[model samples]
Target: MRQDHASCNISVGSADLDLDGYGNIMAQSQQIFDCGEPLALDIDEKILLHGTSWKNANSIVCEGFDNRMCQNAFYGAGVYFACAACKSHQYTCNQHKKCCSCKCQRTVIIARVALGDSYVATETRKKERRPPVRSGSSGTYDSIVVKPGLIKGHHKPNQVHQEYVIFDREQAYPAFVVEYTL
Candidate 1:
């Protein structure tokens, strides 16, 4: 198991983002390990980032990712993750005005995502509820991978950042909570 700490600066675009704090999500390791075993003995997992509101981040850390909470299902109705921290940063929210006068900090969850058998999404599938069925097989793809520049849609430009989506909630384990300020 790899242990991550938020002691270094993260470069997003030209800006260097200094983390306010980084801590483990707590109590998710065994669950993540158990969930990946049936998918593959090797466990094809990737450490990805997911950005959301501070309130939602707390909920996720406790209850895990709920695909129904996904507001934008551009790639599919699932929890979305980004390979680049900058891409995930775009979704972070500063919703602290009503609660306190302190500078609102943005939150991003660094997760272990099990992308067992990924299908590259060549086109926009906004209405797709899950990964499409394999062309010549009865089994459906385990996850979706949308590479940069493949999609053209009204809501999104030719996607400039890579994204991964998993329909099963257990497929992702929130590993770390990183807080930062712009």
Candidate 2:
């Protein structure tokens, strides 16, 4: 984690970029991430490694490619290279007798490689299931309510969780964002 108390300079790489032609730009230097390895960063300060995007920006916001999901889900320091293919399913049910409801669910795989050896990363997706319950079912239950009855119901939610070793930089990517360190 980098500190916000000081300002540091970093380099941006414009892939096949020209002084006149604008293209996807990313951080080019490995030094930034290398120095951030030992620092303990808060959630907000992590932005130094992760770039940002704006709806108004014409070019790719995070990586050279325009991925709204990836741009909005920026974390750690690196660029999104590729994503795995996925499919989705929708189901309609009536359990509460209040009304009919439908849900659309899908699973997607995303990958990012940070610059430098100061960090290591692995992406994971977890799927959770809950058994349907009667109308009186209460307590801490996560599920889409269905028509009031004994009908068993299930819902699938896809979540992305990533773990990184901050102090280790054997397989990290170059850092683009920089902040002053002690």
lDDT of each: 0.67, 0.22
Name the TM-score of candidate 2.
0.16
Please report how far candidate 1 places residue 46 from its true position, in Å: 0.6
Flag clash pairs in model 1. Answer: none
- lDDT tens per residue, model 1, 107-165: 88988777766777778788888888766555566778777664766366666667889
For all predicted structures, in order, the TM-scores are: 0.71, 0.16
RMSD of each: 11.5, 19.6
Model 1 accuracy (lDDT, Cα): 0.67
Backbone clashes, each candidate = 0, 21
